[model samples]
Target: MDTSGFLEWLKASLSSSEKTSDRRILRFVHPDDDKRFLRSLRAERPGSKPLRGIRRLGIIRAYSCPVPPEGLPVSFGGAIVWEEDIRVSTHAILAAQRVPADSGIPWGVRRIRAPEAWSRTTGHRVRVGVIDTGVDFDHPDLRHSLERGINLLQRTALPHDDNGHGTHIAGTIAAANRMQGMIGVAPRSAIYPIKAFDYNGTAYVSDIILGIDWCVRNRMDVVNMSFGMSTRSKSLLNAVSNAYRSGVLIVASSGNDGKRGRIDYPAKYPQTVAVGAINRKGEIASFTNRSDSVDIYAPGERVDSCWLRGNRKTMSGTSMATSHVTGAVALLLAHKPGLTPEQVKTVLKRSKRPLRNAKAPRKTGELDIARMLQVADKLM
Candidate 1:
């Protein structure tokens, strides 16, 4: 049967059941079947009302619907209904202390030796997509670094920071108000903030998948994902894989569960460059998820960056650490645009500085931008 037939059958099968109001259904169709799939959704059956709140994510060739809670096959007519899950921001708000404009660069940026690599490339022309809460466009440090971004929650609105997490993350990646405020690792890089999460820093897995789709379609060079969830979602994995295959480097947080060997989804996925956190003393953070899956570490403790309402706040987590790595990746991509995600990860791993304390510290270490750039230079 065609896609519309399958959708019609599925709708009929679910509508006959009693519990159809509480659950959401995400249908994944191949790109070639998108038009037919959407047409089926638009066509009204004789007795049923049109499907409401249908979200179409064309980049991923998927659409989400509200369905009943009943046993349904995983796949139908070449479409897969993904399991529903929630993803949260991986950072912890330490405090809301404001810093002086002359506070200089944040310690995290300086510790990574980003300044040393500035002479060669300061992430000029690199587009970094931040899939998080949104950004504070009015923030002085980030005013000029932001590019037009999409709001998945409200399609017609701009992706403005409401939770402050994206603003901080963006500041770490490319804030450039050097004189009026602090500088980020890649001050010249443009940030495209994709607001998938709400003010509470929570987002559905489908929204995140849509965010990654936006990144790939928009030609973002690097994607900074600071949120994570323990449960694995195949749809999320497929989205990450698709973005990586499209030559977009994905940098994600290793989660802040303090678990020794467990990393979060998307980060746990091998296609992404997973990052962990370190403190000022260069020791592995107590809250960071440490494991072989973690590709590298960076300063994440008590880190300061731009916040909502044009302010600065101190936060901590693998999310902050991930931002540092995201900026570093932007710097590398700025210098060498053709570098693949694997090549970028390899260079980052090779240039890591040894951790002051951790088991098997040599296996993975902190990011060293100066050394990373040097390693990239050797490839030229």
Candidate 2:
């Protein structure tokens, strides 16, 4: 059917139904045609309210709008494409008991040998964007590491932690409290929390795309995505590719499905560095999604980090592993400020410590930050 006929049918269908419809994101084939198309859509239904929450995803040349069901056309003569705003969740699985804080560095931090390379570069001045739940801004351990961040959920509000997931990830990346609390891999690095996810640890695909766009525009050296979705979104992939081309290194979790040869989106995408989880015994975590696409593994089992109300918690997931790698990337960037994502990945790959368990065939080696720096030196 023609575009106008399709729009009329959609409106009639929606008017006949008693249920409310969910919002869908729309992408224009040519970004220049966006206004013309929107004008046409508005012209069809005169005096109707315009689309709300119209977020311009400049990187992907798309718009995330809450268009009413009646206003949404299935296809707009190939000028625009639309997709459901799919949900994405954090990869963290909280342990039953909260672990007491240890004044020294966490085992995961030590395992990666983050401290060994501190004398050379502790990720000084590197900017790492964390796209997840908001952070605990008042947490003492994270005070020095945080910068003013954006809250996509609430534009006027500071990106504060309603859920502890982001704080945990932030602490692992750059918690700088040295005397009474633990130090992270990149203690001097700056963390810019992008609150895309909510207190429920869930966010829509549009929100994540906005977060990635923010990262690219803000010139973040590295971005840590500790969450994943099972299905692929072309919109998300486009944003990732744009960010990668803009010199942003994205580190993402493989997933927690415990399935062999299957990983999650964003990580599964070629532009991102896909990471899986490992335990203290240096074996792959059974819960971690295994696949040949996984670029590396890191200590993820029972990791301790900052939580809400200035507390500490131990959580487990590939999310934790991705944070470790993010911090390590920050360290690399601090030492060699202009290394491309490809170069950074090569250094990590070259310096990885071989896993003891050969049974896990697809798993790559664990992170070795000290060795990574040595490898970087040789490239100079």
Candidate 3:
């Protein structure tokens, strides 16, 4: 629901006078101006509005602030890294902390074969709710993954995918993208979208709780939550616990704060599976939150997956990796039908792709679906 007010402001400034351009950018603006700017933009154009009179200058991938900008910057001044525009600055890192662990590099998602799961059960019939930003249901890879999503911004039950993060998470879970071989853990699984995070990836704790309840009432077999906050509320934990009792497999992302050894809540809650990130080297991502609370690690860095507006983006975070586990559980459940949640966790623990076990760094281990299927065979 928020528009690029910074860009809009810049457009206004540029149009106001090619002469007043000498004025300091972002100066004289309050630190909370971004919020006000967005509110104003919303008051003007509600939805699906094209930024008129603004130049379609490529993009600023990341604008690292030399001083962290206090909070969110009030102005768009400073060196920005545009897709086509090159600037100089050693301190300005990308706004995103995502680092590429893998490129377009092909790797197996590790699926159950016909013996354990049916050949026809591509998870197509099952619906998994992804409570994040809305998904681009039309994305070739995510079209099959999407069913219908909610736009909390518009307060509507329609599909709205402004941010590409949700689409990435959805694809990792079940991107049957035209069957382009870009399969998720459960490519056949359908996705019931939920937009908790806004376009800027900002969401509230209550929104998350409400989203979980919605999933529970909808009888979603699995709920993939790839976002987290530092707070630990009994209400949120109770919601997860209740959802678990409702037979919902809750999977959450360990926050990528990179402070080390701290597990973000929701993921740390017993009701959910805490997932970490692994780079293309098959080594743990240094930025991934590490601790015994972490249940499993999966590919998260530089993951090339579905995006909004018919595009593909390679991003990194435990958020994307958690979807792998969610889809894997769906596949195992569809195949084994009788496996309990504990049994599912056991299979994941025992069949890991084996790391240099130095003190069992995490609660479980690295996820290896291939090994999990083998473990399931023995359990049967």
Best by lDDT: 2
Off by over 4 Å in 1: 9-35, 42-50, 71-81, 85-87, 358-360
How many pairs of residues collide in each model? 2, 0, 7
Candidate 2, 222-340: lDDT as tens digits: 99999999999999998999888889989999989898989999899989999999999999998999888899999999999999998888899999999999999999999999999
Model 1's alpha-carbon lDDT is 0.84
- Mind giving the per-residue lDDT tens digits that candidate 1 earns over 1-380? 26776677557655664555443436554655667677767665444654545666655566666555554454562455556545455455465677666666999999999998899999999999999999998888899999989999998999987888999999999999877798999999999999999999988887888899989988999999998988887778878988899999899998888998889888999999999999999999989988999999999999989988878888899999999999999999999888998899889988888888746456989999999988988965
Residue 73's lDDT within candidate 1 is 51
* Candidates 2 and 3, the one with greater TM-score: 2
List clashing residue pairs in candidate 2.
Answer: none
Candidate 1: pairs in clash: 20-68, 135-161
Candidate 3 residue spans exceeding 4 A from truth: 1-121, 178-181, 356-363
Q: Arrange candidates by TM-score, highest first: which order? A: 2, 1, 3
TM-scores of all candidate predictions against the true structure: 0.91, 0.91, 0.68
What is the lDDT, from 0 to 100, of the residue 285 in candidate 1? 90
Ordered list by lDDT, greatest first: 2, 1, 3
**Predictions: Cα RMSD each:** 3.0, 3.3, 12.4
